[model samples]
Target: MPIKASTGAAYARVEGIGAAIPSRVVDNHEMTQFIETSDEWIQQRTGIVERRWAAEDETVESLSLEAARNALAHAGVEASDIDAVIVSTVSHLIQTPSLAAIVAAKLGTDGAAAFDIAAACAGFSYGLAQADSLVRSGAARRVLVIGAETLSRITDTSDRATAFLFADGAGAAVVGPSDVPSMGPVVWGSDGDQAHVINMNRTWPEAVESGLPSQLTMQGQAVFRWATGFIADAARRTLDAAGLAPEELDLFVPHQANNRITDSMLRHLKLPDTVTVGRTIRHFGNNSAASIPIALDAMIASGEAKSGDTCLIIGFGAGLVYAGQVITIP
Candidate 1:
């Protein structure tokens, strides 16, 4: 007997988007109390005035559920309609029983297949790529992609370098079959040699032995150089791969890492002035994986971005990894 192949959707598109911001806000002045930095310096350096930190009542799971529910509602989809769930984050803090599984149950996903990915700041895009593939390959019909982070818990507050850069939040999107091609090819890769540029200060076992919590560490200058140079070129390649000219792009939403880096990329890409860029980092801080999707939801809500707009989104961090793609705004 001959085997049969499963058929799937010809294309996939993001049906809707949503975000969950933490309740507590941490301004630059509060950052100053923990580090030797000033308000003007923080804003001038990173374009961040303040960022949100989770309240005592908020947890990664709760944020994920909120974002997921909102996305499902926006998509006009029931929880049971989701065939799979993909969560991208480094803040789950557990080694097993993945956050995706827990979130799926909480969202009443009807036993949808669920798992998690750890690609640091590039995680959301990475998860999107997987969801697109899964839907198109018939492995799943509809996929929920969530990017959430609670970097505040792992941040070394005494370290002046990163004390103000990390925050907490969650953002999600529902991807389903599309009648037309709305998603572009994903351009992604990693450079393990530069993994040390952004990483934790210690391993779990090491932290346990030393009686200290593992905290995030970074080489800021190196990241800036790589992002502006290599990542900028990658963004250009992403736009080109999508068959879009710089002028044809309506929005540019890169990882909310640093405003200076965003400016440098703008110079490199030479995008026209009409293109709306994502500057949510000024208020949200660098929430790692959640940055891109959070920016997307905000831009759409604020009218800076609209449905059917062509947007270029890219993410890079930690693993010195990167991923970019052109997506039609949902």
Candidate 2:
């Protein structure tokens, strides 16, 4: 039997799911206007045909608010009922007041514990783990976890390597108490030594003096090697922590960083063909921290995965960081 909360308190389980994909769809052909890439090349390489780009009015907070509202609505919850709010992102530039504080104010969730986490693409998993701990520890009754990003704001649209990869979006989940722990503990770590594999070319202060945009830069080959080589073991470790086997998973949702990465991990795990895999990158691109939740939302929307189904999610990114967990669909 699964272990019950030692405190006799309820454990955290995902109660609601939501996502916001911008209305502006930019296809590869549209990107060809400035870059030297073609639709065929992009599709063959990233398995992405197009992606959404936020409009001028859609700030990170706005996208997060919309997604948070949707999640609360889905769970039959109200913003005022939220006991805590956590926003995960690398795009929101404010350093003083966290994005979570801003989101809570907009949602009327006054006095709620609010903060932001910077885990890059692994953010949602980290947020989930934190929410679980808070709820299980009797610190919060209900928590709103949102992963939002406006990657386009920092991306260089002309850079062929990254231009077609990153985009803007937000995804959220309402986490609450349950009799059993459906949200497993997160397995995560970071390699600060290899952080240079993917990072901004310069700091904001440096860019201000240089009069250049502080765009994202990456050593694609290095990132690919690290992801494919180490992430499979991370997924397995997460499953083991959850008392689940690869064959028991109903779905596999990794960071929509690249289709190839997902494919490689699946093969490494040797999961059965019945496991539904998330291919959200085809439409959403890589929303960084938002990727896993958005992919989870997509699976829920398409009727591919349903409540009670076990899904494995893995998130990896710029800090050369990674996090994975096994969760029951809500």
Candidate 3:
């Protein structure tokens, strides 16, 4: 007798998307109170007018749950339909238990396999790649990928460099079986040699010993160079890998790290003028892993993006990591 083998779907597609933006708005004037910067300077440099910070009542878990629920509802999927959950974030704050497990239970999943990934800003695309693989390999049928962050809690408010660049929010997508190819190959890699470009100022143990919290630090000029030069080429390769021409692309949603960076990439890629670029950074700041998906949901809601539109998405951050792929708007 031959051994039995399990078969999965031929392909997987993003079935739904949702986002949870924190209600507390922190404007440039408010940021100036902490950093020695003016509103015009901040806007001209980063293109950020304001960003959202979580309210006292909002937790990473709560935002994740809300985003997940909204995604499930949008997909017309019952909670029990999700067989796996992936939460991507560096803001979970816990060391042992995973946030994905907690979110899965709260969403009423029937014991879905759950885990978390710490890829900094590239996390959402990283999780989506894993979800796509799992679904196509028969390891899971429906996967929920959530990227949530609360950088406000860890931000060094007095640091003039990064105080105004971080924010808090959550975004999610449901990936399910599809008969056609809906997700393109993921182009991703990291450079440990440049790992110091963006990272924490102290280790946890060091923080505990010194009785002071660690804060994120970045080599701004270095990051700008890497993102604009290498990451821009990577974005072009991602679209090419999907067999999509520049003219065929309907949208571009790069990480909301800086508007200047986005502009640089656009120049490098030379994408068509018809493609709508995501500029949510002006309002949301950089929510790390949550930026891409949040921008996707916002575009869809505002009618800037529509179902079936082809979009190219990418993310890059601490770890000096990067990832990009082409996806059909859900």
Clash totals for all models, in order? Answer: 0, 0, 0
lDDT of 1 at 93: 94
Give the Cα error of residue 170 in candidate 2, in Å: 0.2
Best by lDDT: 1
Q: Tens digit of lDDT per residue, candidate 3, span 67-94? A: 8988898889998999999999998889
Per-residue lDDT tens digits of candidate 1, residues 1-330?
899988789999999999999999999999988999999999999999999999999988899999899889889999999999999999999969999999999899899999999999999999999999999999999999999999999999999889989999999999999889999999999999998999998999999999999999999999999999999999999999999999999999999999999999999999999999999999999999999999999998999999999999999999989999999998
The root-mean-square deviation over C-alpha atoms between each candidate and the true structure, in angstroms, is: 0.7, 3.5, 0.9
Q: What is the lDDT of residue 189 in candidate 3?
A: 96
All candidates in order of lDDT, best leading: 1, 3, 2
Model 2 scores a TM of: 0.96
Better model by lDDT: candidate 1 vs candidate 3: 1
**After superposing candidate 1, which stretches have Cα over 4 Å from the reference?**
none
- Please list the C-alpha lDDT of all candidates, in the order they appear: 0.95, 0.89, 0.94
- Which residue pairs show collisions in model 1? none
Candidate achieving higher lDDT, 2 or 3? 3
Candidate 2 lDDT, tens digit per residue, 260-311?
8888898888899999999999988889988888888888988998989999
